[model samples]
Target: MIKDLFLSGKTAIVTGGGGGIGRAIALGLSHAGANVLVNDLGVSVSGDSEARNPADTVVEEIEAQGGRASANHGSVAEAKATEKMVEQALDTFGSIDIVINNAGIIRMGEFPQMSRSDWEAVLRVNLQGSFYLSRAAAPHFRAQAGGAYLHLTSASGLIGSTSQANYAASKLGIVGLSRAIALDLGQHGVRSNCLAPSSTSRMTELTDNARKHLMSPEKYEALKRMRAASAPERIVPLIAYLVSDRARGINGQVFGARGNEIYLYGQHRPVRMMHAAEGWTPAQADERLPAGLGAFATPLEVITDVFTWPPA
Candidate 1:
């Protein structure tokens, strides 16, 4: 049996804690003894409007289970509001020890058809919100001598997806941001990591393909036959470990997490150098296509097949 990884006196602030994977993580943290501050604007999956009660409901659930918790309904997109949200945790729980930056939204459209508003909205919440919260929490963590950040990214961030350019860009940006923070905060005893999670959530429900796969018995059974499958709870163990003292030495890492499988994401491949003449013209560039493209192509047999898990 696994031992209890209790936080006891620790305090945590979980953004987007009202629902989906965020709520799951928050509840898990509370179960482990942390006094949690659940921050959720409680917006719809498209982030169209607010639902403040969602945040309240999560807080009620936590308290009902004998866990100490408070609810905050605020937009992480607002820097001042985000800072204030973090302050609520400090004020209520005394100090902030963990931050789970799990709030995000998705607005899908083909690249040419996607509206500017959709693109900006997605970036504002998914990328800038994480930045605002991290900036607000860094100082407190520094003063306290330690803390942890777990950003909820997506497998789509690691691999490309159709009609999700904005979402993919934002999620990838998170990985980059976390890496930079991990480097800067390591000396201050703060750690930052990203989790590319595959879990059933309201966000995933927006996609017809995902919903069909999740709700249809045949598809669900097919998923079970796959080598790797993951539930939201499977991600909790990693998040719990990262926030604990056990992960002090593990920094600047990204994880691919799903039901029962956790894989480490390593260094990215850099663009390779190619030989070219000093005076290579546009025509020459076109002529060298076969050679230039050779290095980037996948095997012919696999080109038509879809990959369940693409390379990170």
Candidate 2:
């Protein structure tokens, strides 16, 4: 049997807690003794609001399990709504000790074909939404002298994916935002970390080909072999740890969590720097370009080399 981390008096607000990995984490946190605020817009994958019962359903599940929880329906993309959601948590629970910024949306289209509106729409929800929530919660965390901030990122942020420039950009933006917040909030006792989770959620459900690529045939077979396996629940333990007192010293780090597999993401590797010294002219550059490019030659090589191609 697992020992309880003992969070009987703590309160948590999990944005996007209505379903998928967010719901799993909220359930785990509530099971550990925290009263939770479940905030979700019930938005579709494309950022359109659809279901109204998802957040309510999560709350009901928590209550049925004898865990305290309240539901809030608001788009994290809007600053006013985000603030109101945080306020609702404080009003209902009296204090906010943990926040999981899991609210996000995806707009996928190939570059040169993707509309500016689509790009902005993805950023509005995935990146700006997290910022708005964090901004609202920072003061509360500071006053309490401690809190946990968990942002949901993706493997696409750490690597490249085809036709997902906007999605990748937004996700990568969260990593930088989390790092900055960690640096600024550490002195105030606030811990900020990000999770790049590989779950078979609605987000993944939309892209079947992408799902196949993410899970190798062997890995998929192994997953099928396990009884009662759900990728959503598998990521919860790491989240629980990050929010627990045991992870007090861990901040500004990115973790990759999948079914029964947790790994640290984003360790800076050595880079080969090239410089055009000795007054190298354009002609010289072109002449020696093949050898200069070395193993990094070709457009496909460029695409495969960097996590975000043609960096913005």
Candidate 1 residue lDDT tens string, 1-312: 243655778898899998888898888888888899999887887897864558889899999988899999889999998999888998898889998999998998879999999999999999999999999999988988899999988766676555778998999999999999999998999999998876777776565353343344754444444313455767887898888887889888898776667788765774555666587777877888668876775433211022344222
TM-score per candidate, chains pooled: 0.86, 0.84
lDDT of 2 by residue, 1-312 (tens): 253755678888898899888899888899888999998888888878784659899999999988899999888888999889888888988988898999887877779899999999999989999999999999999998899999999767677666788988999999999999999999999999999876777886664345445665764454343312446877787888898878999999999765576778754554455667787788887887667666663234211233221111
Best-matching candidate per TM-score? 1
Native-to-model Cα distance after best TM-score fit, residue 150 in candidate 1, in Å = 0.7
What does the lDDT come to for candidate 2? Answer: 0.81
Q: Lowest-lDDT window of 10 residues in candidate 2?
A: 303-312
Give the lowest summed-lDDT range of ten residues in model 1: 302-311
- Go through the candidates in order and give each one's C-alpha lDDT: 0.81, 0.81
CA shift at 142, candidate 1, in angstroms? 1.8
